[model samples]
Target: MLTQEPIYPKPFLKWAGGKTKLIQQYISLFPQKIINYYEPFLGGGAVFFYLYNHYFLSSAFLSDINPELINTYLCIKHDVEAVISLLQQHQANHNQEYYYYMRSYNTENSVERAARLIYLNKTCFNGLYRENSKGEFNVPMGKYKNPQICNPEVLRAVAKALQVAQIEVKPFETVLNYAKSSEDFVYFDPPYHPLSETSNFTAYSRDSFNKDDQIRLKNVCVELAQRGVKLIQSNSDCPFIRELYKDFKIYEIQAARAINSNASKRGKISEVLITI
Candidate 1:
């Protein structure tokens, strides 16, 4: 008998600040071999899918602070078709009435909730997952003529990829504390502290990931590096970021925004890729 490796698909939605472009450049920074992988901030999962596709890693720990985002991952893992069916139904009537209803509704199962979330993401303004004070999906209707609503194929593929990973929804510190000291790689993509006040948009929720969060994240990375865990973190190339990883190697890269609404603000921007 012969064994076969897994093949995963690309992320389905258009994610703001997704690291698809430079993820490959930082691959070499990861541990050469590891017992497991840990990603605390798994937005769009660009790095997760990248590793799952190219490497032989079979066990991993995937987590996110946003419950809705984690729910989407779990839904694709356990109930791909059901979520797809619900999303297809959402596609049928994407007017103001149905959109508001779906946004306000709640469910016992994460899969159903995740279906609604994905539907909203596909149809919302610029694919942004902004919410209101009461935690409702509040982004307005998008301008897509005929977007791909239910991608069952990519869903199934991600589901399979997730089978080899343990998914958790928790804080970055908690996730890192649970990981072993060695033979594990942790990739940090925390909500970046904005370069300027005009550009502050951290979407784990409406609550901002302020300078304090960035500082704490740096402390965690320094500890992880000292413990023999390979670390590669990405954030905006700003003074705070440079000072945080002063002893580490930093690389500058240009990233084009794919989901930003303003076309003028969608051009290349400088970013930092830190490895320790």
Candidate 2:
């Protein structure tokens, strides 16, 4: 039998609120055994990759409402070589002019779109995948001296880790249709409710996550818990979030502010990890 390299797979995309840094804090929190794993807000998927590396999954179901994000994951899972080929070309032809052009470029090809997103993500300002109100990706290019636009090794490793996974573009609530048993483990990393008005950073796509959505998510969590599906959810450590998940066992998570344009704004903050 073949084996993956010693290097564990990592999330290919640089996503806001990515859980990579906080995985250590989350390590002890995961159940000793997880048969089937579900992550609805599959952002950078740091948690999923870590769980996969530990051989904790019988099968994995990852979904996100962002179609481009899902397409990139799918392309990597199904056709990583093609995506890597395009990425190498992008890396070879990379420049400020090329970056701007690709940011505006649109295509129907799934692989091309996947490669495009990965390329832009590696080079974009702060690696943010935000969009304008008109639905166009609008983040300016970053000033990375030499960005690794194409990482074939990482891509291939991610593909291997995703072999036992089902990737989809769907709403978060849809996890109810599949994860209905105690054997299922569901992790929710939703767009966190804002801590303040000036810090409204929940915009992963055209739509911003609001208080109502957070409430709806809690309702879904309640239903899932009632059904005996083991669940863990992450959210901002704010009054509203605490009040929303008041019924569950919420733990305060110490996490660094992962992203901010201002260097001073990047500091340690509190978050919550709710479990049932």
Best-performing candidate as measured by TM-score: 2
Residue pairs whose backbone atoms clash in candidate 2: none
Please provide the root mean square deviation of candidate 2 (C-alpha atoms, Å): 2.1
Model 1: lDDT to the true structure: 0.80
User: How close is every model to the real structure, measured as TM-score?
Assistant: 0.91, 0.96
| Model 1 poorest 10 in a row by lDDT | 5-14
lDDT of each: 0.80, 0.91
Which portions of model 1 show Cα errors greater than 4 Å? 1-7, 95-97, 258-262
Question: Each model's number of backbone clashes?
Answer: 0, 0
Q: Where does the lowest 10-residue lDDT sum fall in candidate 2?
A: 4-13
TM-score result, candidate 2 = 0.96
Model 2, 44-141: lDDT tens digits are 99999999988556599999998999999999999999999999999999999999999999999999999999999999998998998888999999
| Model 2 ranges with Cα > 4 A deviation | 1-5
lDDT of 2: 0.91
